[model samples]
Target: MLQSLSIRDIVLIEALDLDFGAGLSVLTGETGAGKSILLDSMGLALGNRADSGLVRQGMEKAQVTATFDAPDPASKLAVYLADNDIEIEPGEPLIIKRSVKADGGSRAFINDQPCSAALLREAGNRLIEIHGQHDDRGLINPRGHRALLDTYAGSDPAKVRQAFEGWQSAKVALEQAIADQEAAEQDREFLEHSVAELSKFAPQPGEEQELALERATMMKGEKLTGDLEAIRAAFDGSNGGLASLRAAARRLDRIGEDHPLLAEALGALDRAVIEAGEAEELLNKAADALMFDPQRLDDMETRLFELRALARKHRVEPETLAKLLTDMETRLAAISDGGRSLKTLEAGLAEAKSSYIAAAEMLRLKRQKAAKALDKAVAGELKPLKLDAARFETLIEPLDELRWGGNGMDRIEFLISTNPGAPLAPLGKIASGGELSRFILALKVALAEEGGAGTIIFDEVDRGVGGAVAAAIGERLAKLSKAAQLLVVTHSPQVASKGDAHFLINKSIAGTVSRTDVAALDGEGRRQEIARMLSGADVTDEARAQADRLLEGV
Candidate 1:
């Protein structure tokens, strides 16, 4: 609900403040009493187009601020605010403000955060609705018709959506699988030959490096083996220097036992014998380790060449041949087992399709039932609003295949025939303004509990209506206010009499400047205003008595 509005230097409103309340608040005034000024100021805050003309003649800028009561924790407006990351303190009012400069530029803000007019407009849409003779811009957008119908029918649309998405996913999966199977079948012969070739070779990971190392060692060993043998012979052969040294050491060991100098010579001979023994062992090991074969070298080199060639043919490193083998085998297996896998996918898709069809059919049936009830309810409101000749229908025609959607295969549109034998067409195409307002009224009454903005404003729902018809409009407005605040600008005293709060808009001149001010009427003031409305520029005693009678009934 809009709690307050402040306007500064806007057109004829120099500075003004107004407070609103829940329920039906009526603004009544003589013609051209700055009623349009009030609407314009509110439009600024609601993100309507702004220009230099909107600023007062002597002022540089015009500003308007509107404050709204915080939305319920679970309301759509609250959800919208949260989703947009709009900062709001705990229990803070939702404040929207707009400023227009003489230069024809404007700025908008929400909760004091600088924002764009589009965002402001969206937020305003969630909080308020302004309807007039030429406007049914709130509940009649046609997009909300289906959702409102579902709400009226009390059906679970979410479940239907889930079923639809499940079927769609299954369908996509089936198509992808069929495509893959076709591709694999096209390459079946190639896959078979590749798998066979790789199987025969059975190349192992890291084998290329192992084979190359062996090849290098064998090739090098053949060139170095002779040199290694000469070293071994020098240490252990009988005609080598080691043999002469050993003979001299043995002779010294036998005769040097009696003297310290001879003891030292014996120890030195022992050390030399030990050193030679160690060298002989190492030399034997080295000579044996050089066992080489040119044939083995050729075999290893040839095998390595084959691995490298295969790797290049497959566009992979030699180390990855093992992985390629596994993948090719899997592809072959899939090709062999394609029919069974495709059958499984098709079966799943069929089950999902069946579930979706069932849900959509149920929704269709329920909507049909709901549509009939809505038509009857709206028809009942017709005669009182002087629309007895109009006929309302909910058109639920099947959509074409290309237009099918998750909501169902039905295109729901509200159609009206304003005269007997006239073809039914979309409401916007067939109904007059008064007829539309009545139709909208009946819809609001039917969907009063379905939920909408916390406030709804009507420029003149009673247009072209009078007497009991006008009273009925007032009654419905009051009834709607139970769910949300309602403000009406009306000329019917009967309608004005129904207001929970009444305001009178009047204009006056201060020197050469024109100014407009809205006055909240009390009991006496309301009586005088209603009397003035009942009469013409005069509050006759009879009009006052009639006004009292009207207020008393309310």
Candidate 2:
């Protein structure tokens, strides 16, 4: 609830501070007493449009501040503040301030932290609702009717929202699957051809490197074959080293043991002959090993070149060709079975849509039931407000499938007929300004504790009515105060007597200056104010007695 309001340099109000309490508080005064100025100052604090003319004549700027008790921690307003990174402490007050310059520029703040006027407006909306003859926001707007109806019905929208989201998700998945299948069909021939080519090549890991090395070794061995043959001839002919060594050794053996020197020489010649023969045999074996058919070299070159060509075609090194083949084969398999998967996805989407429809239907039923009850309740209030012939209706219209939303498939609006035998039309189209205010009040009274702002202010809600009608309005306002704080601006003495607190707005003029002041009324002061309201400028004893009776009646 609003705790206090302060104003400075705003039109006729030049520096005023007023504290508010819970329940119904009444503000009363004669015409031109600055009661409208007080409400304008509040509108400024609540982020209403700023005008340079609202500033006092001699002041450069006008400012207003409103303080409210902290709302529930789990409330939407609290969550919105947290989302915007505005931190508020527990049990601390929520202070909103606005300043408008003479140039029509304005600045806004919440809890002393600068914020945009839009943010201030959003926060203010959750804290208080101002209802007047010309007001078009809140309950009067058709866009908000469904939420209000849902609140009154105590219907939770979470199930419908969840089902709707699931349906959307399923639809998206099915669409993506269809697109993928179409694309795969276009690439089917290419995938099949590539897979077959890779399968036939049968490329092996490291095959290219191994073939290159073997070819090189064979070429080097071919170059060394001539040298190996020449070495073999030196050891093989009759006059070669091996033959000469063998002949010398035989002569030495014939004169064996004649002298120690001859014996040593013969032994060395025989070893030389044996070693030369062994060397010739090893040389022949290496020459034979180096021999290779020319066609074998051609085959190796052909294989290596083919492998390189395939690697370049696929934009991969030869070693990775094997893995690429496996991937392409898997894609081919998916393409072959795409029809089955697409059918599965379609079925899932159908199931999700069915679930959403069921949930929406249940929600619509709940709203319809609540609407009937609401109409009856509002009907009960109409007669007391002097609109007995008027009829209230909750119109529930179904939306097209293309326009369906998370809130459900229905559009709800409040309709009314102010005269008997007249067709029902929208509330705004059918009701006069005074009638509209009373209709809104009746609707509000019917709504009761279901939904509303933390504080509700009605500007002259008792306008154009008197006697029992005025008393009936007061009775309902008092009843509303039990659930939320209420402030009424009225001239009705009965309404004034119903307030938990009373404030008197008065205008004073001194020389060239005129100022407005607000004073809280006590026991005698309240009685005097009520008597003044009853008897105009002059307060009569009879009016005082009536005021006494009115006060006692409460």
The window of 10 residues in a row where model 1 has the poorest summed lDDT is 132-141
Model 2: per-residue lDDT, tens digit, 75-181?
A: 89999998987888878999999999998799998899998888888888899999888888988889889999999999998999999999999999999988988
Model 1 TM-score (2 dp): 0.93
Query: What lDDT does the true structure give each of the candidates?
Result: 0.85, 0.90
Which pairs clash in model 2?
none
Q: What's the C-alpha lDDT at position 155 in model 2?
A: 99
**In model 1, where do residues sit more than 4 Å from their true spots?**
241-253, 256-266, 287-291, 510-512
Error of 2 at 1 (Å): 0.8
Ten-residue stretch with the least lDDT total in model 2: 284-293
Best by TM-score: 1
In model 1, the Cα lDDT at residue 370 comes to 93
- What TM-score fits each model? 0.93, 0.84
